[model samples]
Target: MAPPQASSIPGRLLKALQSINSSAPRLIASPTAVGSNANPGASRRASVAIIIRLRPEDSPPGGNAASPTSSAAASASTSPFAQALPLPGSPTVAAAAAATSEVSASDKAAYPPAQKDVKQQLERFFEQDWVKRPGTTAEILFIKRATRATDKWSGHVAYPGGRHEPDDEDSRYTAMRETWEEVGLDLAEDDYLSVGALDDREITTSLGKRLLMILSPHVFLYTSPETPVPELQESEVASAHWIPIDLLTAPAARYDSVSVDISTRLAPKNAFARAALKLLVGGMQFKCILLPNEPIATGALPSPQAVVPNAPLKLWGLTLGMTLDLLSSMSLPTDAAASKGSTKSGDLSTYPHAVAALPQDKGALFAPSMASIFPRFSYPDINALIWIFGFRYRRTLKQSPTDSARVNWAGMSIGSYYAAVRRALVVAVVLRALTALGGLGWLGWTLRKRLQSRRTARALAL
Candidate 1:
């Protein structure tokens, strides 16, 4: 028989494939996919919205919790972590007194005795560990995460929030639910007034890849005169504190030269290898703020060594950015110029002078408006190549000559050298073309002159 027609074979194969496909199970979409289809905006919803309450002028300062006669004393005495000390004559008290005496002597030697004012401040911090009500400023709430070896954010300072759950009506509800779950501060809409929301910022990996989570910070003011203390939810939150907004605005709050490790691989033990690795994967530097300290639970151990003590609660990264946004919304200066002359060494005494001396020329300090916190650049995609090449050239020129690895041709950096060589080649090409054109013009002139002379000679001969 003749070979089976290819068309007939394809039809048979197609029929068999169709039958198999019809029997196959249909793929189901995930909950997230379904949710996105139902509400497209849910994908852009913020994972967290931290509340910022404006503290009243009469509110107690941070250390007011430590004073027995202070308004915070009532709350402090009722805290679950608070306990009565042993009687003075008891064996427990005597032994503890002796141990304290020994430690005090050693501490005095290691650290000079604080000045009278400083000593008073330290005493206040010990007495009142929580933010007290009736204050002249605003207080920003922060949460210390529960320690877990497996979690990347374990034991880190963060605002109370979590990923959006299906049960939540929206992101705001998600924030409220998480806050209540994490800190047991039942924040109902009637309990607090909504101040506003900050811009949404994307969460990213160490290498800057976008994650599914986004942060939307929502500010709120407690309606009641007194600031309520938060009950800790030990599973997710170790402690929560309300930090005074004034302290945050103070110049002493800012700390520079804070180094952050961003290496993806384990740091090399060898010195040379470590240096090479550092060059390959550089660390990020940030301006961090020291947040007010929270009262440590009785018998609780100190925080992890990685936790920087620049502030009682260190605020950095996205939290700091959001804090700045909050400040800007209040018409307060968010730029470093506001903190001018307010060096890390400056104390609270300098606040009045610094505030009074704020630079008259606000334009010199930062962008004229809060909306311009970060400058925006608009350019067409068609010019992207040119812009990128120009940027590379400028960056190369700014690099140190000692960084030989960055240097390409001779002493010039790669980009600059490449651009220079390209320019030279272009110039040479243009010169060559001009010279050829000049030669042709000269030849044409000579030929015309010779022909004229020949014509004249021929005419004379005739």
Candidate 2:
């Protein structure tokens, strides 16, 4: 009677255990954390950032700390698996050659100043290892711009970053500041963690003309359990999307070519513009990634006109290039041939039906005559000739030392004008040569006929 029943004690103990479990803090993995079943240092989540390094010559000093000579030496002392992996177009061979010729510290001190300078220059040239350029590693954020008549990039999907401001200390700050301003997501906040940066890419026109501005892509991680909802600044962003890292690998995501109208933007008379126009007018084919059901946080825009209700967002051009870089950095094979037997979950066939379908236009881009001539002859050859002679012609046309004073007839460079004239001259010369040959043949025929008639007359007189 004094002691409690055994069944009652067990129930009490179970209640106590439940209370303890409820009070305990749940352990959340860091964005960079690797799964227990995954290969060491391999990340299972798409939130992780991969820092891609460039060759020494191509990159600024201190970009990467590992020296090629030291790497080679370390590899020589270790097993085959420990040896540096051979990368496409890597400078390992050159590094090894330079390493072999390297002098000890004592030998360098003994050398004269002139000799030391020469050796240092030589070392600088050969010391850097050239590896196959690494792909981009960051899960970059892209923003769909609001449709505005004044904005050149209106309705285009682009990164959240913008031009550097005087208030920004550097490009990293510009990216972060822009992120906060446009998306209402403060990258500097506690929930977000800064990752490394990708190499700076030069911004260019759609036709491949270089621009003055350069872009630096930075990666970040969101540590919170819940996905942060982006508050879009309607003036800039129409909608913001968090594209899955694996979305690009989907089968249905592939679009061989999609037509984009860019004629209005390009100079119609420019040779480069002409070539691009020819390819794009009928719809230029491009490697594209489609995101149909990706999470999109809509902002202040008209209902029907805002976002494609349920259509897939097509990513192409520079955006597509950046996506490829991200995949390449992950060491994931991207080629159609290599991706076929892959064991990734990115196969769109396994996902729901695509809400938006890309137009199927896989037919030949060029006419039969144009297609046949393109391989053996094309605009590129003509452009090359213009480039070489155009400058000289421009110099000749200069009336004064100043470029403005120089005559720019027809709103084009003297090179272009001369190129057109040269082509006309060639055609004219060909026609004249043909006419002269025809006249000579007629005269010869007339003489031969006269001789035959005289021979017949002589025979009749006999």
Candidate 3:
């Protein structure tokens, strides 16, 4: 199926933001919004900036390509993309007009229009000549953190953010400060407008029982597409990527699993331990999406554009949770239940097909990510056992979505309520350990039998 036109993105996005206030449960998460009570043992607050911009088709940052703000001369000239829009008499517009025309004037008068209810303006926005002028694609900024021994999220694909600092005035400032320090974007400047904040999130250790920090994701839009290229800070950031929205929504771009090394967290100090653990565990599976690394230049950091491997980057863990919320807002109205159950908030009615295009899990309960869930082993039996254990836990969360659980993504809760998910991992590890010991015992028995036979042969010969 054809992807949704990038032309319609701005309207849909605006519509989604407009509905945040009316949501039944009030999932308005602002970066500056006062921090709510912390979860037990979770005192830290962190914020990330989700910076979005429109990448005009085939136009460079400073390219002379025509823009929405360009002279009237450009709009007067015909553009190729304009032809595909629903023209006045076309069936789509006609159907829409027919639908709205049927709405009685009395009914229209009784209920004032909201951004969500103004389907006609949204339609008109799409119909504008400039919108269809082979215009821009929406893209969000992401950064690959430099490998740091101290950072647990080192080398992970993430939005720009850091833990709230004492000098910072609020969580929003933490995001703004870290963004300028890590990437070169000055979000506080006039070039960007703060759209709104996503619902707050919880950072937790694996098993989802422990709380680390509360995460607030703030959204910002570029006032102009000609915003300057990002300058990477070498000490914290390696490269910056502007990921296209189309890729994020594509069902094909979603992967069922990613391979994570088991030794990174468990056996960092001893090579022998690492090798033994890896030999047994190999690589475990987690939910992930494929992302290409297109790194931009960095003047702030000397030769700071770190060389990325040819492999596509994986988007999982807490970052994935934030992304899922962004994707859900695309279909927020269709599911008011989301507003009530979700801690988050999207306007995807402009493109119905992409709404709820939530990435699905194949075998594991990869409901976005809370903390890094322990991965399932390569052994199918072990994985099946793990899933079976999590079955009740997953079912409970599914039923009680509005239970104030701190972890949710794509309309699903993950951590804090995933004790069973963690317990399953512990069970799998114990089983693997027993199986390894059983195999060693059989090998030892076989060798002892062979040695006895060899001695018998020598004695017979004597």
Candidate 4:
């Protein structure tokens, strides 16, 4: 089907953002006790900004326009946002440069407070003449990281962010500081407003077998009349693009799979052992979105030479996880559709309205996502089988779609969505190991028999 109505997205997004209730949190990366002394700003936590902005129509929408900000410098005053605090510091050339590991009291209060009535402020923001024009598609910013020899995320499609610096007052400050340092866009400025926070994600390694760090994805809404022109940092960023939310939710965006080298995921560090693992598991098939390089605003290299024009941009892994959380936050569920008759006419109305603007990956997830915390072996089809079994098992058990499964980022732990898949994984591994042992045992027995026969002069041979 064609992409969802673009103009209505802001309205839907506003509702989605306003509806977010932080009292009850979703299970992110891994669980941290609600009342525990665990700090979100711990050294392991890193932050990324999911910045959403309106590419305002060049003209005005006289009919739907809302009242304008009264300040003489409309874009200079305090902007409104989610109840959660936005980074509070006045940014200058020095602050952005130093990015010291410490945030002082003055540093924390550097920027103005964001308007807290998200519902009201956002409704007004979207109603502005420029934003209400026809075909006003919302866009999210994404950056390609500059390739570095030691950077694990080198040359990857990711949001702008970095780890919490010792000087950062909180996780939000780290995201703000990094965004400024990496892309030259300051979150503290009036040009943007905070959209609030997403669930904390626990980044992991070895197929979620080890906790690498905690990831906080902070969403922001751009309120400017003009498209954000980022001054790309040649050292940290390769190119910056404004991807329309419409393209992200389109059917074709998620139709393909990415081949990942997961052989090293759970293998020992020894070169021989890793190579042996690769031999056993040729490659892994995981989900990915074919992100277009359209509307590339700026880059380190000239547009043509900046990105391999021919090769498609692939988005997966931790970045994909954060993207999924953002999409989930934007959706509100609908009544499960059903048709009850011999005619068997399926009712399309039962399909989720919430998913209209969201990519629908066929999985046990309540919303579309990359599907697994672990990669699937394409040749052995171990991962694919897990998904298939999980789907069928859930159906057999008569589980509700609203209660679709969730995943843990920290390690191999999973929610109900992968319940059957987990069992299938154990069964498959055990059977494969047993088969290998049985073959080796039979070979050993045959070799012993031949050796014995040779030692004793066979009657016929004499």
lDDT against the true structure, per candidate, is 0.42, 0.39, 0.53, 0.54
What is the descending lDDT order?
Answer: 4, 3, 1, 2
TM-scores of the candidates are 0.47, 0.42, 0.63, 0.68
lDDT of 3 by residue, 380-432 (tens): 65456656665544554345332334333322345423555456556766778
- Per-residue lDDT for 1-462 in model 2, tens only? 122221221122222222211221111111222456542111211111211121222433222231111112212233221222321111111111122133222211211112233223223322222311122111235667778888766776677766555434344455665666666665656555443343334344543332333454555544333345566667777666655443443322443334554444455467776565444332223334565534346555544655456676767555554444344333311233344444442322121212233222322110011001001012344334433544543444343212223222211322343454355334444555576788899999999999999999999999
Show model 2 residue runs off by greater than 4 Å.
Answer: 1-141, 250-252, 268-283, 293-295, 302-308, 332-462
- Worst 10-residue stretch by lDDT in candidate 3? 87-96
Instruction: Put down candidate 4 lDDT per residue, 320-412, tens digits, no spaces.
Output: 767765655555443111112213212111111122222233322223433332345544456555656665433433432223242222222
Q: How well is each residue in 100-146 modelled by candidate 1, as lDDT tens digits?
A: 23222211121221124322322232223222322334456787777
Q: RMSDs, each prediction?
A: 28.2, 25.0, 13.9, 10.3
Clashes of each: 16, 6, 3, 14
In terms of lDDT, model 2 sits at 0.39
> Which ranges in model 1 have alpha carbons more than 4 Å from their true place?
1-46, 54-59, 62-135, 250-252, 265-276, 296-311, 332-462
Deviation in angstroms for 325 in model 2?
1.5
Give me the overall lDDT of model 4. 0.54
